[model samples]
Target: MHDHRRLGRELHLFDTDPLMGAGLPYWLPDGAVVRHVLEEYVREVERAAGYRHVYSPVLGKRELYEISGHWDHYSDDMFPPMRLGGGEGEEVVLRPSLCPHHALIYRSRSHSYRELPFRIAELGGMYRSELSGVLGGLTRVRSIQLNDAHIFCTPEQAVAEARAALGLIRRAYDDLGIRAARYRLSLPGGGSEKYVPDPELWRRATALLEEVLDGIAYESVEGEAAFYGPKIDIQITDPAGRESTLSTVQIDFHQPERFDLHYIGPDGGKHRPVMVHRSIIGSVERAVAHLIEAHGGAFPVWLAPVQLVVLPVGDAQEERAHDLVRRAEARGIRAELSGPGHGTLGARVRAARLVPYQAVIGEREADAGCAAVRLRDGRRPGAVPVGELLERVGARAGDRGAELWAAA
Candidate 1:
């Protein structure tokens, strides 16, 4: 229910075309950069967390989901099957999640107990069938690029993996200046109709969840879990009392077994491994929506697309301004030259659209070969070498590390 209309329009970050099938966001040039910045940051963080990245096809064979228990257990969340070949014949579904594919990958190789803990990360674009009323802007959408990972490990390794995931989540939230966030310790099935078959496994799973949650003091309630597992949700409550879950770490005891996945034990005997499904930043689209609302259109210098715009005060200073632009570009700074959009130097600075930092290069500053750099922080680092300014932005980028490894 947050009003994103103003930010969406003013920033020109996203466009929702009614004719292009609503709920799909059209990322304008600037918006795409923001998206890439986030995606790159997250990929780097996940790579450092002992995760091996993988790519999977969006469409899957029907048998794959059937063996993974997704077809029978969580059917409501998936998009309808696409019929391939000659007629309305064979059924193949657009994957709603990446667990089944990752399961197939594990089964593809015979794993050993030494590889007991294997994490696979995939930045996959998934499709879902959303209710009509729920589809609007980026909050609820039909398509999403998700930070999907599946951790295969022995039950004993669960706690360590879960703790590491929590640390990453916290780091991300802190870097983004996200406060007022907490974890919802999702309990295992409590004999409700909301839960699935297999009561004994549910009890064992809940016990595992309790063990992890107790250590973190994560508050939990019953019946909040997926039919197959217990999960920890990272979320926040806004001033309007509306709550949103941004990330999830689920301990699944059922899926691996459903697919009959196993690893060779030290005894050379076959043993089942547990699966932990997680998304630290959840969906890129939804996270952007959260940030758009949370920061209220003021992205930090780290994530800003066009960090600075150089405006030459007069025609005589064009060469100097262009030189500064090249210097900023070399440092990976998204800088631009202000053309004839504004008549006067003062007007150009005032009308610096979609750009936070504006450097005014007149005769005096050009002679000094320095940039009169302005900060989005409301202070100007006047007369600075382009290299010095790049160092400052680089430091800020490192500080604003992605939300996945940090927490939502």
Candidate 2:
């Protein structure tokens, strides 16, 4: 089995230190490049889909979770409150979730019926008080950067918004080459204190999710729902055959009621709006962990940290190789020059096998004003003109295409 934790270390992707604490792995430079690219791709996709990004503080007052019912219903997973003063001081805590702060943002201003579906997205951090025994690599982290979003819409618009969120999730999965194991309609279990004590609210929320999942194949799993409501979870299987949720779309009425969020209807009357929560790629850490295994560290061209590496066959072609690297970088391609100092040309190419593209510059090819192009998949397209080569690679990377080369 291709394990992400092992590959992560072998590839210098991430590392965990005792002082940094368990369940907190820091990304190496190359890993940070991959992460930054993925985050930018997500932001672009969300921006195109009409999601307005926002920033919110990671810490909130202790009473904030109390009002959101998290303190009462889900406090066990939260960190102990940090008292500011010695005697009877105000308390604050690292937020376990971002929805409460988002609710406050929604309530910050008045809204009209025309702005029914006010979508807000954030690539924000949150903390969880996970036990050390449960801590692993990126899959279970104490500090998580979530690709979270919330939509406040009228009751009539809830289902449609949720369906759109699911569509976005599928688009992201396709782009990232993620294959979901299954789709699950997670419902609340019977007589569980972990869940809110409101059958009618659960019923209404479950119905909304069911409608959102209409005609979509999904399994109804009890006790898998969020504390506030039912959700549509997009499940993925790891190399160990362990199934976990990677993406989700949920309908929540509880938070709206708790926050007393409302909008002005066409009749100029105050109307309660439903909150739709969704995560396209879920946590960045878990997503990267799965990707490390999925691609086995051989990422797609657009997502590869080092998209192209230029290898010089001999000292005579060193200048040409450097020029090629410069040109490639100028074209916005992540390229590096591997000269004789690194070793033989063959050895250099082998070392850069994980890179998506390799350009070999030899005396003959340099004289001919072209270079031999090789793909990570071991396809040799022979020697091509230098300008044409960079253009093609840049275009492919820009389009985020799965294929290395465009059609003739």
Q: Pick the candidate with the highest lDDT.
A: 2
| Candidate 2, superposed: residue stretches over 4 Å from native | 85-88
The estimated TM-scores of all candidates read 0.92, 0.98
- Residue-level lDDT of model 2, residues 1-408, one tens digit each, is 889999899989899999999998999988999999999998998999888999999999999999899998889999899998785789999999999999999999999989879999999999999999998889999999999999999999999999999999889888889999999999988658888889899999988888888898989999888888889999999988999999999999999999999999999999999999999999999999999999999988888989999998999999999999999999999998999999987899899999988999888899999999998889999999999899999998898788987566
Top candidate on TM-score is 2
lDDT tens digits, residues 102-185, model 1?
998999999999987999998898888888888878878988899889899998998778778877777777766565467787
CA lDDT of each candidate?
0.77, 0.92
Instruction: Give the CA lDDT, 0 to 100, for residue 94 in model 2.
Output: 98
Assess candidate 1 and give its TM-score to the true structure.
0.92
